[model samples]
Target chain A: MIRLQNVSKIYKPNTGALSNVSLHIKAGEFVSIVGQSGSGKTTFAKLLFAEERPTKGEVIIGDWDISRIRQSEIPILRRQIGIVFQDYKLLPRKTVEENVAFALEVAGAGPSRIKKIVPQVLKIVGLSDKLGRYPRQLSGGEQQRVSIARSLVHTPKILVADEPTGNLDTIHSMEIIELLKRINEYGTTVVLVSHDRDIVNALKKRVITLHDGEIASDIERGKYMI
Target chain B: MSFFLSALRIIRFAFQNFFRNFWLSVITMSVFVLTLITVNALIFINVLGSATVQSVQEKVEVSIYFEPDTSDDIVKSAQGYLLGLSQVRNVTFVSAEDALVAFKEHHQNDAVILDSLEEIDGNPFGSALVISAWSPDDFTFILEAIETPEYQRYIKKKDFTDYEAVISKIQNLSDRIRIGGLVLAGFFILIAILIIFNTIRVATYVHRDEIGIMKLVGANDWFVRGPFLLEAIMYSAASTAIMVGIVFLSMRWLEPWVSTYFGGIDFSAQQFFLDNALLIFGSQFLVLSVLGLFTTMFAIRRYLRV
Candidate 1:
């Protein structure tokens, strides 16, 4: 479950990224947030993971309010919510397996569990064979898959993908979308933020449209209608 | 179990980072070694300088020559009085006959000096008291303490002026060397800090993306910082170890040359280092590690906020 009540994020010098945004989604729902550039779509996803605190409002994930999450508690909240970025954000020097294991390692997971879970998640993301390959040795799609695999190491309850397919081609983009759908079907809530209209329309899921820091519409089975 | 795993992983990451950025690590460690060398060089100079001054001080003594007609009782009394003073290290009383014989032996190779010494009738050399003080600075005090009216009347000459000038010069030079070495050490330390700071900053920049990814993937601040901190300490330890090797090897090689150069003064820099090996190298490692840790923490603070 996720809820944002009247969340407004205003930057300095009167720049507002999101304003008066109120939204909620039940568990295990697949939702796509679509907007033009600077339409607060990324900001909304960021709030879900406590990446950006709202200047004024409440952000509650499950039963915990995180409007002003403590710095030390941010990692705890992040481990429960998977985040995928447009950049893939893989450590260039680390191998595919090490990249995924890094997430578990940070959480103080033992070596045996890390060894067991890393391969399993890498298999889910179809990167089981490229365990020794560094990020630079992989394609953009493969690198993004590694990022997704890392995010899944914790079996996060909610997945927030911010422009996950922004750097990928059509086929790769569709592949990432299908992966998200599959993840959602596995009983995990998925929040997809993107400006790609085709990806949104093709999803045919609940769509939330934002315009000028405000949500224009929230429709079940909505198409991309910016 | 998890704590140990995490610690193990952090150490592994530290080694990975160190070797992954091999050239950067080398450059950083080179600067660190240079800093340690400067520190150890200052230590060596201080120890050597102190030993040399001490050796020079030990060789200096004042000879108080008595009047030719002064009684043996008066000279012995003066010797006893000088010996009783806490400032005096020792006093040796040489009778007129013994002084004449020693003077003859000293100049026997020179016929002119031997003939000149033999021309004096009936052992013309007077009895003398040779006085040594625990410290060179205490010589003047001891001499002043012994200059009583009764002893002054019997004293023909007190030969302390030449030794006084030499001791004063040595003390001045020692003070200058110590101050100059300290200033040089301080300058090197500052340069070391700046270079290390820049090194860590550049390293953090190179890994900025990795840091952000780690944080995004739920790595806590300590988890993110652990590797950098450990890497800093690794640099400290490695640099210190290299410096220790360089110091000992160089000291051993130069020991003979140093001894010959100082005219066989009873001072061994190599022995000094061996005697205080733990204190000297241990403190250097501690200081270097503290500096590295501090600089790494400061350099990586901004990047860790991801």
Candidate 2:
């Protein structure tokens, strides 16, 4: 349900972040975008979310083209895509419940809906008991789960977890990947972008590799074959 | 979202942000209070100076003594004539008998002066007209108005008190206060802007990750920017409230001291502030909020891009 046609991203002074990339994935696919550092994987993920506009080509989702989405429309696009960062981007001062509820709050969800959905998501991430704790009081795994819970508030069609387990231990990383797999199974498109070979191989799902801003390979039931 | 719900949430977030950064808020408010104090104190001094000038003007008058052989009826007619002019605010007829009593009272403290006053068999004092004018400058017009040929023939001396030095000093002080108040207020406003700007920048920097995460979680532009804008307003309101309290207390304490130092010139900053409470506080709140909001918006623009 997502496609990029000859997308290229170049920064100032002739620095090409992603060059001449063409890719597509069907709906309901659990896909992994894998590449080493400076291989344009992050830029590719940014392109999908319109965080960085491509220097050339188009990014289309379903029937809508967002290659040059207007600034005012970015928030609407973002509301449809759930994005998780490497650092587990939770507000430090907010408690677990407040942080999760904040997502619905920003979406203009009513207090009753926020109260109802936040607990459900937090329960799914298995952090219902820790709702009163702030981000600083949570373990790395718990914090990441809060971020995931927040991203799920809108029930977005596509969830992009960019290095979702980048800061976690092996056990924590596996747990996060399992959570993503479960989320994908529920029919939401999951695009997991990471360089971790072990995590990629463990999935045995569709994998797309990027080599210096170009898509090097794509395979169903692929391993971490860089 | 309904506007009311959104507003309530925004206000809640603003208050949360305020208290969460209590020390920073305090410092920001302290700087704001100092700025307000400078402005209010300047207003108070300006008022006091004007009142002092008015009080001094009231004490100044010209006394016109009639010729020794001049009839009492002429002096009374001169009084009536001086009183008719719009420039003259007041005119009192000091009869010969009244002048004699005043001279005796003046020399009562000195035996030699008393003996000389007694040596004069009859009352040596002449009937006079004491005239106070609307302004020091109007004294000239009032004195000129009474110098008609018919009136001048019976006049022996006309004395306007030597208050040139006092009026000149007051004029210089007034000019200095106006210019100095403007210059000082301008300088303080500049400093307040810089400090508030830097404070907002630092506050935004502290919340940079929060903003990024909020946007990532699908917050609209207003959702993300509302708390900061509202926080700016809260800062202005809180500081203004504190300043109002401080101003009231200080004015109350300083009123008696000012009255004593200026010979009871009715130096009442408290009264002045109370009379114009809405104007003074309303304008202060408006200026401070505008400054705060501007700084906050400028500081957050770079972060809101994501």
Candidate 3:
């Protein structure tokens, strides 16, 4: 579960990335944060992981006051939360399996455990056959799948996919959305941040729309609405 | 993970970084070898130059020529007095007749000089004492000691042997070589730092995306910085090893040439390096590794925030 109360973020010189925002999501919920380019959606997601702290309010994740988290504690929080970027940030020199194993390695997982879990997660992402391939050798969809597999290696409580399908074709996009749905069915809280109308409309899930740094609407089984 | 496991992983990742950027490794190591070469060359020159200067100073001696009528006993007594001083290495007394014979031998190639020497004078040369000292610095004292009133009246001409200019020139040249070598070595040290810095920076840039991903995946700060520091040490170590090989090989190869060219005054560079191998190599390794670590630390500070 994640909660943000009266969160306001100011860059500098009167530039507000997010202002007066309060939101909450229950455990095991698949929530989509919908916004335009500068609607504070990315900033809101960053706050969940303490990548950027709130300038003026509380950010609580499962009773942890992440708003005042120390620098040393950030890595632990990150291990508990899986974040996927638009570019699918994989180590270029690492093979697909090595890339997936890296997450467990950072988490101090032993070699035998890493060897065991890596293939299982890669199987979940349906890329077990391409474990030996580099990132450059894989397609955009496969690369994104590797990123998803890495995020799942830690079995994080929350998975935030910021534009997971932004660079994919329609078929791959739907595939990624289905993967998110499958991940949600396994009880991990999912925060999907995107503005792709078709994907948001098709999901018909809980959607929170942001306009000018404030939440414009929040609906149960919401549609994509400006 | 256990501390041992963590150390193992760090070393593994360092090797990965080292081999992944193999060319960068070679460049870094090559640059390091160059810097060491500069330092070793300076050492060799210092050894050779000291020997050459000492040999030149030994060849320089002042000759005190007494009056033509000065007795052999007196000249030999003066020689004995000169030899008694600890500063004096040796003193040889030449009689007037013997001096004339040596004069004829010196001009033996010139018939006119030889004929003139036979016809004009019975013995134009005086008894002279040739005095050598333990060091060129002792020349002043030895010459002044012989200028006492007991020996001054009998002294006809004192060839002061003005080799100060030569010795000063040699000293100035040696100082200049050392100073210049240091300056050059300093320049190379700077280059080595920059190259190592740039090597780390480039490695950071190459892994910039991986760094972000590692942070996102929850890597601790030291976990991210450890391999980099290790890689720097590896570069320093490998380069130092290669430099040691080059130094050992070159000195061994040139030992004969060194003996041939600088034949006297008792100096051997190869022996010096061999005797102080640990001190020389250990200090070099320590300095280079510390330099590398500092550069790596500085270069990684900007990237560790992720």
Give model 3's docking category.
medium
Q: Please provide, for model 2 over A86-155, each residue's C-alpha lDDT reduced to its tens digit, 9 standing for 90 to 100.
A: 9998988788999988877777789888878999999889998999999999899989999999889888
Q: Predicted chain A of model 3: TM-score relative to the true chain A?
A: 0.98
Question: Isolated chain A: TM-score per model?
Answer: 0.99, 0.98, 0.98
Report fnat, model 1. 0.86
Candidate 3 lDDT at A15 equals 83
Interface C-alpha root-mean-square deviation of candidate 2: 1.2
Superposed model 1: Cα runs more than 4 Å off: B69-80, B105-119, B148-153
Considering every candidate listed, which one attains the maximal TM-score? Answer: 2
Per-residue lDDT of candidate 3, residues A119-197 (tens digit): 9999999998999999999999999999999999888889999989989999999988999899999999999999899
* DockQ, cand. 2: 0.74
By lDDT, the best candidate is: 1
lDDT per residue as tens, model 3, B178-272: 78767876876677667656765665666666676678788888888888789878877888789888988998899888878767657667788
Candidate 3: the clashing residue pairs are: none
What are the models' TM-scores?
Answer: 0.91, 0.95, 0.87
